[model samples]
Target: MEKVINETDDKIKQYNVCVSYFDTLQECSFSCCFPVNVKPPVIVSADILKFPRTEYICGENFALDGIEAKVCFSDNEFLLYNYGENEGLFSSDVTTLNKTGNNEVEIKIRNKYNNDGFKYILTVIVKENRLVSIDIGKNNEGDVYFRLGKQYTDKVFFDHFSVTKHFEYNKGMTHDIKNNVVFNFEKLQYLGNGSFTGVLYARYTENEKTYYGEYVCDASGNNRIILLTPLPVSLTTEKAESVNISNLAQKLKSANITYKVRYQDNTELTFTGDVFNNNTYSCNGVTYTINCNKNSIWLDWKADKMDCKETSLEAGKLYIEDFWYYGEEDLIKSVDFKNEKTLIFESENIIPEDLSSYFSATVEYITGCKITINGNQLNKSIDKENKLITVSYNGLKFQHSFSYSYSSNGD
Candidate 1:
């Protein structure tokens, strides 16, 4: 028998044994030495060979490929590589899952002999990107309606859907989805005059995967065409007796006045012209007011008809019967002295103690009489060649003419 073994390094290794015996008489040999203990491989378990799929959606494009890890090693067990196709050994600090809900993803592995590293958390949920909700109704001949589903729940239906015009999605006009609503839907060509926004795009299937939501719909339809019957909050003209304060606007344009209206379905329209010519008239949006009366003039025109006596015609009075005036300078209609009627002052102590701030005026009162510039004086410098500045009003008076002169190269 003979045995010998040696060749191993990591510390301790030696083995030699020889034992020989040849039949009965001469021939003997015996040797023994033993020791073999070379360590350097002890990592019994590393985990994860297949386990990575914890729900994902929001912008999903994640990749940790088949996710593999095994490792073992006390004497071999390998299976790494697939951190999404070779990440040296295997690694991941998240490679695209785009945050939505819980999303951890650590996953690492390395032991290229002894670098030793292994971790694995990987939570990943990420959902968001669902948007299917739109519902706005109104139908009883009043049109406008839409519907879609799922968000706060309305039961949800739709194996396929499509609607457009939130901005014309891509080219405009689309529509599909029948029982799930979408009736009438006017607003003409959409864009807003009051409502209607659109854009649905849905699809279905829940746990079998195949979603596609996206709904908007705001300002739901109705550009005004819902009158099943209702338009008469008030309308009823016709009344104009005697009117003639000097032909009150040609007798209210020959007085045609009619109006009528009445609708809740009993239907009856009528709106004659010159409806009192502007004593106020509007119809659908209600305005009316023209029950005229005026007639009885005579401010003065005595041909001796008992010295003139008719009077009742004053609602915005203007009954002139031969008048004449040229007095208070015709009530003065122009006088705008907003400063400078002649002012030259090179600092006479910076003159202007408040001569009404250099005499102001601006009066333009005619028939609405309001004449101003009440009194502003500073005319007391009689010796330095009269430097007046008076202003007064009502009994009218004006004068500004200043002069100070005191230059020292501050020109």
Candidate 2:
């Protein structure tokens, strides 16, 4: 004998059967089935953060920290809840997006059963910000301090990184509200001119970005000189023994501009060509010149860009005044001064012996202490008996005798 039961809709039914006992029953068997319904895992909320889009200031990079997540979207399939993201996963780990305005991303999580789950799509906005200014300063002891921002922090600040100077401006600087540190100038001050190449240095701070204006200036003592943006071009070789114009043309062919190079003279060559399709120009510098002839190519470099003719300056043995630099330091290249005739040395007490001693003490001192040096305007004379080194330039005369002095600093 066997009993069977089933339930549905809050109702039950039962039946009993005998095996091989009834006239029509030969054998019997039984089976049962049940139903169950389980819901899916729950998703709390999706967090989205909007980062500040701006340029990097002197000491400021894009803010890699400080992200506030907001519940913007969630999954529609499940009973959604609100739970903050895992602390370690969200903090200090922001995606460095490209220079675009909008970014979209997807995240995944797991439920108590470890079942894979997903949430609604999240969107992030990224903006374009480029570097505007870099300011370096020093305190009393020459410790460097730099702050980057779109607004100026203080006034009367001193810069000691390279040269320390007191700074003042007519109109205060401005900062972009939308971008925390995009500096917009209000009033620029005009600083005095530089001796070498006439490049001016101006000092000002707007927003958080510090401005050490170079190259130009305004009337209110603000520097107006803008820096040159770096070029995409680079020298292919360490030492360019020779330059092939045809090869250069093939290498750098963009738009209608092509580069051509040729040697003209041993010391002075001329080049008439274009690099980026600007104009056919000529250059006279230390290395070589690229001059284009009517029918052929010509590259030339002057042999004596810093050569002075042989002459004697002896004004009654008081020393011949031929050429003179204001200071005892070496000549500086590319400085435009109010007066080139007047030589000015920043350090008044510097002497030739001290300069030579410093050079000997430091192994790599050649690149330090940059000054405008021009040997072309100088006249040199040698006294065989006294072993004297005499030089005359710009109506000034200098003479010195060498004495062998050995120091423990060098062999």
Q: RMSD, each candidate, Å?
A: 21.3, 28.2
- lDDT of model 2, residue 9: 21
**Per-model CA lDDT versus the true structure:** 0.43, 0.30
- What's the residue-level lDDT of 151 in candidate 2? 27
Tens-digit lDDT string for candidate 1 (1-411) = 354332223434444444554544555544544444444454566878687677776666666667766777666655555566656776678667777989888876766554566777878778765533332322233332232110212222232223321211222322333333422212233432212344444443334544344433335543222211122322343434443223233333344533455443355656653654355544332343444223222111111111001143212221321112223443355555545333555544465455455555655534333444532632223224454433444444433344444456534
Kindly report which residue stretches of model 1 are placed more than 4 angstroms away from their true locations once superposed: 1-68, 72-74, 77-90, 97-107, 110-250, 253-280, 286-411
What C-alpha root-mean-square deviation, in Å, does candidate 2 show against the real structure?
A: 28.2
Q: Top lDDT: which candidate number?
A: 1
- lDDT, candidate 1, at 212: 42
Model 2: per-residue Cα lDDT over 1-411, one tens digit each: 353332222222234443433333655544543433333334456444543333332222234234334432233433222223333333222345554555553434333222434443445555434435543322334111111111232332222122222323211333322122222222133222200112324455455566453322334434322221111111111112243222332222233322232222212222223332332332322233333332222323322121111133101111111112112222222222122222222332322332321211111111122333344434444443443434443343332233222233422
lDDT of 1 at 267: 51
Q: Lowest summed-lDDT stretch of 10 residues in model 2? A: 314-323
